[model samples]
Target: MEKISYSRVWDLDKVFIGGSKSSQFLEHMNRLVALVNILESSIKSLITPLSINEVIKVVPLIENIATIRLYLSQANSFITCLLAENPRDQEAATLRGKVAQEESRFEKELSKVKKIFTYTKEDVWESMLETEKLQEYRFILNEWRENADKNLSEAEINLISDLMVDGYHAWGHFYNNLVSSINVNIQINGKEENLSVGQAINLRSHHNEEVRKEAHYVLESIWKEKEELFSKIINNIAGFRIQVNNKRGIKSILEDPLKKNRMKEKTLNTMWTVISKYKQPFSSYLERKAEMIDGTGMKAYNFWAPAIKSNRVITFEEAATLITEYFSQFGSELEGFVRKAFYEGWIETEDRPNKSAISFCAGFPLTGESRVFMTFNGTLLNMLTLVHELGHAFHNHAMKSVNGLNKRYPLSIAETASTFSEMIIFDAAMKKANSREEKIFILDEKLKRSVMNFMNIHSRFLFEQRFYKERNEGIVSANRLNQLMEESINEAYAGSLEQPSIYSWVWTPHYYITQSPFYNFPYTFGYLFALGIYAKAKEKGKDFEKDYLKLLRDSGSMSVEELVMKHLGEDITSEEFWEKGMELCVKDAEEFIELTSS
Candidate 1:
């Protein structure tokens, strides 16, 4: 019944004194290049032997590498923000090319460092860690040594890294451009209009059933036209990954992601096993949700359809206040970061052309600051996303005390703070709901998140695994990908859906990233993991917030398994721990069913 303007575009002046192509940025780029050259030259003398003096000499080089990476992150973050606002910016794209090229060189230099660690004797390396300064990076140093057995020759690895600039990573950029440039023609209120693919997809959450279904159909049809191109991009990326793994003598495809995620296979298997037990409950949740929306139980297109149309609109200012209020209950630091992000132009929230459809928090480790990008559309989902990214920013903020090497965390635990924030905000909203409709609406939102993490993400995880296995043997056709996606969705959703989301492979972007493979399951892991932490917070009240921040701070310095055990006194390798998180979702599904009962 009322209008709300939620657009608050960010100011990038704080990040760089000048814009992306400013002389300041160009000078920073020159400095980054010079640093890489110096680091490369220093790598020649980093040979292995029983010399404490050589070890000491290598420390500063390691620090320089970290410093170079910090500058690269700032440059890349600024470029990403610029591109998010205008995908067609050639200067930004060129700058991205330059950054990637420089990063490849840096990776080569770092591999040389890894080689030195690989060649060093166990006793010598252990003795080096005895120093307090070096001991601070024990986790990172030990990780490199442990994983060195899987590394190929330095020349081959460096070559692969170089090729990746225009080879593997190029496909990801191509996919981003393709997705941004796409538009679908749809009829809205008896008038035909052209909308971006993202705009069309958002209509899935529209209050009108026909509009939602049409949007889904139009999107599917559009993606079908580009199915061949999408298939090639994904298959090629998989092919590249498999080739590297084979050369490195890696056994299972999951080995790389597991190691990078800092978890044992037992832990991953245990979590997935717990998730499998909830398929039936999710079926019931979806059934009740569908019944509330329409007579039909569940259909693929209507999966995101709204339950109730509420006149409530949350302005960006109100969203910020709500997040700050909720986070302050945990601690002032959490609240302070949110407030600073709003005041310092750390967030870009305007709805404008060529802006990125997704939301992400980009952390500049060197500066101890993060930039969040999201286009707010005055919806509850948008607010939830704001808190989610802020959660990520908060995680980055907690790591400011640590060195650059230790600030890099595994993807599995990276979602902890974001999901924890989401739970606090959602629960607060539920408590403040003044009517049954409002309660149902909030419940549906919560249930939808569960189903997505449990079902959709599971399907994606399955699809990627199957695709990689098939790709390892031979190239997979577009049709085969569709078949695999369908089978995966059907299995994950327990045949509850009327039809499968067949084109999901084309719709999702995670598969394109070269740095992180098998990125789907981490969402499920983070959702449940954060829910587990949220349970602890509920039990301990404000006291647990201190421990929570501690967990975030130590994420990069320790393994996920060790971090959980040390902080929560829980064993992640056990099924019982994961069951605790599964039960939280199960409780929500059961409550939703009861609320909608006849």
Candidate 2:
């Protein structure tokens, strides 16, 4: 109702008065450390195979630990915002390490708790869960107990947690630092200028063909120069994970990711099978895209290039207005939440140097708020990304009142809200386009997203799958890694692209994440899952909004198959469900080809 001055910089002062130097934040960390120590002591002193009375006592301790972890997460979220705002902030980085140490401490205690649950009598465990205090956490508690079967002894798990602080996780931190330090010098407008990796990557989508080509060439060269170092980082990271999984008697790397995603192997297999069958329309779309751009075929650089030249740049205010307007079309609750986020400075979109290239939405359970981080360059794609992150924020908002443990949704479903948001805006914008070029531009953007989810992400998934298999035997050479990447990309794209990104493994951050393995497939899963939900919304109209919110609320507490069955009444492990989603993509690709033909 009122005009708000949109600021690019987020307001972190309200969350913590000082950035990394905040005494309040330091005090909070100190309190968290003390609580973790208490939790560890309590877990250590607990008697196993206890009576019902002891179960009640342990439940309260679990609740306390959860509360303490929430506060720790709040601290971590604040430090993440600071680091993203200014990557060179050494103090923030130091705080991050401290937070990691505290997290390790908490996790060690949690392992002990899980051990207790693993050994507890089923009757007592069920009775404990039936108690009023533990009723809401029954799902997550049962899940933990079930997963504990896959874990090592409590002592071994604690040892792994301790070692990870300076071992596995350290490599991930090093990779981030190396990525931040990357600066490329490329000729723009006949003058050479330095660009951060984030800015250089943004140039891949530049309207000018030559600029995009140069950016790609320079980036490839830079990564190639540092390939050996990256190779070691990735090898060690994978090596550490492989050893851990081996110790746990885990047979495949996908087991961890599948369990974490609450998805079955059959569902993953079915989805890929469906995707493999539907590659023709997407290939046709790429062929048409190349024809429009006067290129012989699609190349790695041309992957993100705009189909038509348009000088229009959507500002932050305009992007926010567009998102809220489309979001309101779905539900007033989402619209109101987004407006509140905007007015409260919950998003950081400042286009500045020394910022992380990745975009994320960090939720603070302690405050029941979320912070979105991204570098906005005023393109339609950037607006869509903003909407995507806002979707995550809305999901967080939907679960704000749920128990902390139940709010830990897997990465698979996490993308549902964000991708759904993107579809809403893209669909609305397509319908409102006033010219052929505008329509093409919007459609191209939409198809670009689909290409990314289906083709690009698939390549990463394939590369990781092969790399781990080879890495199991021994260390993979940089050259071998490159070959794997290229081969995977070629296959994933179905030989559609003229040039495959061979050195992607050297620069892609997802491969190095220590917390999650195969961080690639969940994205495709989420994109397709959201498409299915969007199609349902179209069929059900405004009536679906209530059910949609309920789905978000239940996301953290159920398996992928169970959640889909309960919410959408479809079996995720079936080809019919995946085909429905793939059909939507086929329609878009067919429409794009038909339009461009004219």
Best by lDDT: 2
lDDT digits (tens) for residues 358-461 of candidate 2: 78898888878899998888887788889999999999899887776887899999999999999899888888889887887888898998888888898999
Regions more than 4 Å wrong, model 2 = 1-4, 149-151
| Regions of model 1 farther than 4 Å from truth | 1-7, 149-151
Alpha-carbon error at 217 in model 2, in Å? 0.5
Tens digits of per-residue lDDT for model 1 on 197-235? 656766776667788788888888888889999999998
Error of 1 at 459 (Å): 0.4
Per model, state how many residue pairs clash.
Answer: 0, 0
TM-scores of the candidates are 0.96, 0.97
TM-score of 2: 0.97
Task: Name the top TM-score candidate.
Answer: 2
Locate the minimum summed-lDDT window of 10 residues in model 2.
48-57
